[model samples]
Target: MRIYAHRGASKDAPENTLKAFCLAFSQHADGIEFDVYQHENGIIVFHDRTLRRRANAEGYLLETPWSTLQTLDIGDGERIPTLNETLGVVPTNKWCNIEIKHLVDVKRWVNDVKAALSQSQIAIEHVLVSSFNHHWLKAITDLWPEVKIGALSASYELDCTASAKALNAYSVNIALDAVDKTFVQTVLSEGFNVYVYTVDEPKDMEMLAQWGVTGIFTNVPELAKRVMAKRASAKDAVSDKS
Candidate 1:
C-alpha cells in the first residue's frame, strides 16, 4: 500500500506548512496530502477552519485576510503556504493529493491548481483532487474532464460507492473508522481504489494492507513505511519457509 503523509509529516512539523511537506518527501512518503481553502483572494494550504489549533490565534479563517493570516506562525515558525508555494515543493514523480476543504469558485481554484502543476511541472495524472462535496468534484470534472478526482466520505453508504461512481473517481478516500474488510472488498469489487485517512497505528496499517487498500494517509509516514516494509519481509520469509 502507498503511504501518503497526512498534511505532510504533520507529526513532525506544522500541518499543511511547507516544512511538513518537504519533510514528508525527505522521509520517502509515496505522496503528500494537504487541505486547501479558497481564502479572501487566494487559495491557502491549511487544515482547520479556525486558527486555534494550528496557529494559536483568534477568529475564523474565512474572516481573516491573507496579510494577517500569513503573519501568524502556525508552528516551528512555519507560515501558512499558498497553493503554489506548497506545490512548488512536490517532487515531479511522487503522487499529490489536494483535498478541497472549501471553495467558492471552482473555476478559479481549478485554474490555480492547473497553473501550479504546470509551474511545478508535475504530471496531471499523478494528482488527485478530493472532497466530501461531490458537487464541487462534479464541477471540477465538468471544467477539466481529464482531471482525476477522489470521492471523500466519512460514512459507509448503502450504495457502497455511488458517489465515486457518479464522478468516475480515481479513488474512494474514506475515513479510517468507516472502512473494514467487507467495505474494502466491496469497494475493490466495484473497481474503485480505497484510501483510508489518518491511520497512524501500526496494527491498523497492517490490517489495511492485508485488506488490499490502495493507500493510507498517516501523520507518521516514516513509521508507516517501516511497518509496510516489515510486513513485506515477513510475508517473504513465510513464502521461503513454505
Candidate 2:
C-alpha cells in the first residue's frame, strides 16, 4: 500500500510547510498530501479557514492577501507556501495530493494549477486532486480529465461508491476510523481505489494493509515506513518457510 504524508509529516514538522514536505520526502513517503486555498493573488497552503492555529492572526485565509499570509510564521519559523513554490520544492518523483479546502471560483485555481504544472514539465501522473466538495471535484474532472481525482469523505453516510462514479474519481479517500476490510472490498468491487486518512499508529497501518487499502494518509511517514518494512520482512520470512 502507498503511504502518503498527511500535511507533509505534520507530526514532526509544521504542517503544510516546505520543511515539512522535505522531511516527508526524505523519510521515503510515496506521496505528500496538503491543503490548498485560493488567496487574492495566489493559492496558499493551509488547512483551517482561520489562521489562528498556524499564526497569531485572527482572519480568514481568503480575506488575507498573499503577502500578509507569507509573513505569518506557521510554527518553528516556517511560513505558508504558495502552490507554485511547493511544486518547485517538491521532488518530481514523489506524488502530491492537493486537496482543495473551499469551493469559490475554483475555475481560476484549477487553471492556475494546470498552467503552473504545464510550465514545470513535471510528470502529470505524480499529481492527484482531491476534495470533500463533490461539485468542486466534478468541476476539476470536467476541465482536466487526464488528471486523477479522489473523492474525500469524513463520514460513511455519503455513498462513496456512488460519489466516485458520479465524480469520475480514480480513488475514494475516507476517514481511517470509518474504514474496514468490508468497506475496502465494497469499494474495490465497484472498481474504485480506496485510501484512508490520518493513520498514525503502526497497528492501524498493518490492519489497513491487511484490509487491502490502496494508500494511507499519515502524519508520521517514518512510522508508516517502519511498519511497512516490518510487514514486508514478516511476509518474506513466511514465504521462505512455505
Candidate 3:
C-alpha cells in the first residue's frame, strides 16, 4: 500500500504549510494530501472553518479576506501557501491529493486548478481531487473529464462506495473508523481503490496492508514509511522461502 502525508507531515510542522510538504517528500512519502479553500484572492492551502486551531486567531476563514488571512502565521513562522506554490513543491514523480475544503464557484475552482497544474511538473493523473461534497466533485468531473477524483466520506454508508461510483472516482477516501477488512474487500471487488485517512498507528498500518488497502493518509510519514518498509521486507523474505 502507498502512504500519503496527511496535510503534509502535519505532526512535525503546521498543517498545510509548504515546510511540512517539503519534509514529507524528504521522508519518502508516496504522496501528500492537503485541504484547499478558495477565497476572494485565490486558492489557499489550509484546513478548518476557523483559524483558531492553526493560527490562534479569532475569525472564520470564509468571513476573512485573503489579504488578512495571508498575514496570520500558520506555524514555525510559516504563512499559508497558495495552491500554485504548494503544487510547485511536489515533484513530478510524486503524487498529490487536493481535498476541496471550501469552494464558492465550481468553474473558478477548475480554472484555478488548471492554471496551477499547467505550471507544475506533476501530471493530472498524479493528482487526486477529493471532497466530501460529492456535488463539487461531480461538477469538477464535468468541467475536467479526465481529471482523477477521489470521493471523501466520513461515514460508513449502507451503500459502501456508492458516492465513489456516482462520481466514477479514482479512489474512495474514507475515514479510518469506517473501514474494515470486509469493507475493503467489498469496495475492491467493485473496482474502487480504497485509501484511508489520518492513520498514524503502526498496528493499524500493518492491519490495513494485510487487508490489501490501496493507501493511507497519515500525519507521520516517516513512521508510515518505516512500517511499510518492514512489511515489504517480511513479504520479500516469505517470497524467498517459497
Candidate 4:
C-alpha cells in the first residue's frame, strides 16, 4: 500500500505548512496530501475554515487577504503557503493529493491547480483531486478528464464504490473507522482504489494492508514505512523457511 503523508507529516510539523511537507518528503513518504482553499488573490494550503484552530488568530480565512494571511503564523513560525509554493516542495517522482477544504469557486481552483502543475513541470496525471463535495470533484473531472479524482466520505451510508464509478473516480477515501473487510473488498471488486484516511496506528495499518487497501493517509509516514518494512521482512522470512 502507498503511504501518503496526511497534511505532510502533520504530527511532526504544523499541519499544512511547508515545514510539514518538507518533513514528509524527508521521511520517504510515497506521496504527500494537503488541503487547499481558494483565496481572493490565490489558493492557500490550509485545513480549517477559520484561522482559530491552527493559526491561533481570529479571522475567517476567506475574509482575509493573502498579504495578511501570509504574515500570520500557523505554528512554530510557519506561515501559510500558497498552492504553488507548496507544489515546489514535491518531487517529480512522487504523487500529490490536493483536497479542497471548502466549497468555493470550483472552476477557478481547477484552473489554478493546472497552472501550478504546469509551472512546476509536474505531471498532471500524478495529482489526484479529492473533496467531500461530490459536485466539486465532478467539476474537476469535467474540466480535466485526465486528472484523477477521489471521492471523500466520512460515512458508509452511500455505496462508495458506486459513487466512485459514477464520478469516474480513481479512488475513494473513507474514514479509517468506517473500513472493514467487506467494505474494502466491495470497493476493490468494483475496480476502484480504496484509501483510508488518518491511519496512524501500527495494528490498524497492518489490518488495512491485509485487507488490500490501495493507500493510507497517515500523520506519520516514517512510522508507516517502518511497519511496512517489517511486514515485508517477516513475509520474506516465512517464504525462505517454507
Q: Which RMSD values do the candidates have, in order?
A: 1.1, 1.3, 1.0, 1.1
* Per-candidate TM-score against the hidden true structure: 0.97, 0.96, 0.97, 0.97
Give the Å error, residue 4, model 1: 0.4
lDDT (C-alpha, whole model) for all candidates = 0.92, 0.87, 0.93, 0.89
Clashing residue pairs in candidate 4, if any?
Answer: none
- Model 2: per-residue Cα lDDT over 56-80, one tens digit each: 8899888887778878988899999
Q: Which parts of model 1 are misplaced by more than 4 Å? A: none
Clashes of 4: 0
Task: State the lDDT at 54 in candidate 4.
Answer: 88
Kindly report which residue stretches of model 3 are placed more than 4 angstroms away from their true locations once superposed. Answer: none
Off by over 4 Å in 2: 119-121
Clashing pairs in 1: none
- Candidate 3 per-residue lDDT over residues 107-209, each given as its tens digit: 9999999999999989988999999999999999998989999999988889988898889998888899989888899999999999999899999999999
Residues 207-234 of candidate 4: C-alpha lDDT, one tens digit per residue: 9999999999999999999999999999
